[model samples]
Target: MGTPQTVLHVDDDPEMLALSTATFHQFDDISLLTATTAIDALDIVSSHSVDCVVSDSLMLPDGVPLIEALRRENKDVPIVLFTAKDWTEVADVASAAAVSEYVQKAGPDDLSTVLEHVGMLVDGDRDESLAAGVSAVTEALADHADAASAASFSLDENWELVGQWVGDDELGIVVVEAIEAHAGLPAIEEPLYDYIDADALEELLRPVLEDEERPGIEVRFPYGDFELAVTSTGDIFARPEPGETLY
Candidate 1:
C-alpha cells in the first residue's frame, strides 16, 4: 500500500473540527489534522507532510489570506475551500489565490464531495494532456479574436469537437459538442437524457452571457469527467473535473 495521505482541515468552530475528525476516521488510508487558526494550520504544514488542505472561507484571517500564506509555504499543495459561501461571492479572489478546488457546503452530503476532491488531487489524477489542449484553445481565441467566424480543435484521445460560435449563439454548439465528445457517443446514438439537459443548460447560460451588466462572469459545470467553463466573451474552456478519475 502507498503511504497514507494527510489532510489538514482548518476551521474556527470546534464542533465542526470534531465532526470532520469523526468523518475521516472511517478512511484508513487518510489521516486528518485539525486547526482553528491560519497560524496553526501553517505551523502544522511546516512541521508535517500534508497532501491537501481543506479550509472554511470565513475564519479569523479568512480563507483567501490563508491560501496566500499557504502558497508562499508550498506552491503546489492542493487547497480546497470547503465553504458555505456562494461561488459568485469568492470566485475572483479564490481564482487569484490559485485554489485547487471549491466545494460548497450545503449539507451533510457535501463532505463526501470534499473527500473526493482531496483524494483525486492527492493521487495526482488530473489530466495534464486535457489541460494543455484547453490552454491552447484559450490562447487561440485571444490571438485570433477578429480573424475567424468559426474554428475546430481536437482534444487528446478522450474527446474532439469542431468548436464554432457566431453572434448570439455564444455557447450552444461548443457546450453540446464537447459533452457529446466526452461521452464518446453522438447525441442521437446515446443521448445523455438523464445525465445532462443540454437545452436547459443553454437557456440558463443565455442571460448570464447576454448580461452586459456582469461583464466578467463565467459559468462552470461538470460534464462527465470534464469541467467546462464559458466566459461572457464567448470563450470556452475544458479541463478534467477535479474529483473525477479521468481514464
Candidate 2:
C-alpha cells in the first residue's frame, strides 16, 4: 500500500470533534488523529509525522497561538483553520498569513470543502511540464460547459494554460471538462488541487478577495513547472503542461 496521509483534527467541543471524525473517517488513505485542545494537538503533532492539521479558530487556546506554538516548536505541518467564525474576523489568516487555508463556516458541503483543501495540500507535490506559456483555452471546456451555464470568470483566448478554477462547480467536474477540451491526447484525470496546493493559492488570493472591488487576483509560484493563479471571484487557473498530467 502507498503511504497514508495523516491528519490531526483539533477542537475543544465534543460534538465538534465528533463531526470532524465522522467527516474524515471514510477516507481509506487517511489516518486521522483527534485532539480536544491545542496543547494536546501539539503533543501529538510533535511526535507524529502528520501530513496536515485541521483546527477550529475559536478553541480555548485559539488557533493562531497554537499555530505560533507549532512554528516555535518547528512543526511545519500545513494547517487549515476550520472555524465557525467569519473568515474576516480570523486575525491569524490576515495577520499571520501562514495558515495553509482559512475556510468559512457556511456552505452546504463545508466538510467536503475542508477535505478538498486537505487533499489539495496533501497530494500537492507533482512534476509538471512548463513548456507552454500563454495560449487560448480551446473550445473543449466552453462547449461542454454550455450545458452548465456561464463561467464565473473568463479565460484569455490566446493563453498559456495550467488549470481552471471550477468555482461553485464541482472541482472534479470542471477538471474533467477542461482536460477533455484542452490537452492534445492523454487527459487530466486528477483534480486541479493535485497540480498545486489550493491552500497556498487561497493564501495568495485572500488579500485581494478581502477587497470587494478587487474581485480577483493572479498569483504565481516559481518553483513548480507551471505558474499558479487563483481568482477570489471564482475558479482556479494553472498553466497546463503536457508531461504534468497525472494518470
Candidate 3:
C-alpha cells in the first residue's frame, strides 16, 4: 500500500496532545506529528511534508501564526483548529489567514471530527470539511446537553437559572451564569470571569465569533474546585467537589 497521510497537531497542552495521540490509534491509515508551539510547528513543516495541520488557536497571540507561517511559506498545508476554547475571538484572524476548518475540542469526539475534516482536505474538498465540522459540532453540543440532563440535574432539580442568550449578549456573563446555575445556588453578584485566569482561556476562544449563519461556540475549562463547560446554546455543564461552591 502507499504511505499513510501525515497530519500535524500543534498545541501547548501535553494532555491534549496525549489525548489526540490515543484518539489517532483508531485511524490506522494516518501518521501524526505533535508540536507544542507555533514556531516548533513551522520547523516540522519545514522538515516534513505535512498533509494537514490540526491545531489550537493559541499557538500565537494576536492570531494563528502557525497557519500564517505555513501560508507565508506557500506550503498550502490544509489547516484546522481543534480546540476547547470558543472560536469567536480569533474567528476574524483565522478567516483572514484562511484556515480550513474549526472543530471544537470535545475531548472524546474531537479526533473523529478532525479526521473527517482531514479526509475531505486530502480529497481537495475544503468547504465540505469546514461545513461538516460546524454541523457536527452543533449536533454534538446539543447531544451533550441532552445526555447530561438525562443522567443528572434537570432545570427543576439542583440546577440554577444562570445565563440566557437573548441576542448579542456577552460570553463572559454567560459563563458566569453557567457556574452559578450548576452549583444549585442563586446567582452570585461577583463577576465569575474575574476569578479565573482568562488569558489562556481567551487565547483558545479568540477565534470564535458569533455568526448569524452558524451556531455559536462552547468552552470548557477548570476553575478552583469545579469542572465547567458552557455553550452559547444555553447549556452549562458543571460538577463541583463536595463541600465546595462552584461559583
Candidate 4:
C-alpha cells in the first residue's frame, strides 16, 4: 500500500524461491528481486537500494561469505542471514558487521520472521519490537490455518510468470507447513527463449509479461504470441504463433 518495498532474496533452492515469492507478494508494498547465486546477489546489492536482504547461508563456493562483502558497502541496510547450522558463534561477528537479524533455517517460519524484522528495520523500528511482531504473525498464521489457506501467488514481472499455489485443505494447523504449492515465477521467461528472435521479444515485451494470446490470459512478444497453459503436474505449454518453433 505504501511505496514499493524491494526485498532482495538470495537462495539456490527452488522451493524457497516459491515460498518466499509467495509470502512477499502478499504484501502490496513488496517487490521481489531473486538471486540464485551469491555473486548474483552481490550484483543486485551493488545496483539496488533494497529495503531488505535475505540471504541463505549455504550457497556453495561462498555462502555467508557474500554477506561480508555486502556489508562493506551497504552497512546501514538490514541484512538477515538464513542458516541451517547454529549461528550463535557467528552472531557476534554478524553483530559487529551490523546485521539486523540472524534466522535459523528451521523452516519457512523463521525465514518469514526474518523478513518481517528487515521490514521493521527499514521503518526504523527496533529489532526487539520487530521480533515480537514476527512471532505474533507466525503464531497467528499457525492458529488461523483453518480460516486462511496457506497457499498464495506471486508474479515475477521480470521473469514473465504469474505464480499460484495451494496447500492441503485437510491438513491440520501447523507452523510453516509445506503444502502443495505452484508458482509462475519463471513461466513467461520460458516462452521468450522459444521465440523466433530473442532481441525482438526483448524489445517488444521490455521484460513485462502481459497478455500475449487473447485479452488477459495470453502472453505476447514482438517476435510472436503464444498460449500459456499449465497442468496439475507442473507441465507448461506454449502454443507459439505461426512460423515460430520451440526447438
TM-score of 2: 0.46
TM-scores of the models, in the order given: 0.48, 0.46, 0.48, 0.52
- Candidate 4: the clashing residue pairs are 163-183, 163-184, 165-182, 212-218, 212-219, 212-220, 213-218
The local distance difference test score of each candidate is 0.60, 0.53, 0.60, 0.51
How much is 69 displaced in model 4, in angstroms? 0.5
Model 3 poorest ten-residue lDDT run: 206-215
Q: Candidate 1 at residue 118, lDDT?
A: 75
Using TM-score as the measure, which candidate wins?
A: 4
Best by lDDT: 1
Cα lDDT tens digits for candidate 2, 1-247: 4577898888765434544554455455667898877789879978988888887763334435666565555546688888788866777443463788877766324655677678777775310111110011112122222311233235454234433442334444543454454444345445556666655554444221111333335444322333333444233345544366432
* Poorly placed runs, candidate 2 (over 4 Å): 58-64, 92-97, 125-247
Better of 1 and 4 by lDDT: 1
What does candidate 4's lDDT look like per residue over 76-194, in tens digits? Answer: 67788876757875676676667778888874377557666666766643444445445544543343222212111221232222232222221111101211112222323333345
Model 3 per-residue lDDT tens digits across residues 111-224: 667777887886544434344444544444344444434433323344333333322345565566556655545545555665665444443342112322233455655555
Give the clashing residue pairs of candidate 1, or none: none
Residue 154 alpha-carbon offset, candidate 4, angstroms: 27
Error of 2 at 8 (Å): 0.4
Clashes of each: 0, 16, 10, 7
Give the Cα error of residue 112 in candidate 2, in Å: 0.7
lDDT of 4 at 191: 37
Q: Residue 140 deviation, candidate 3, in Å? A: 16
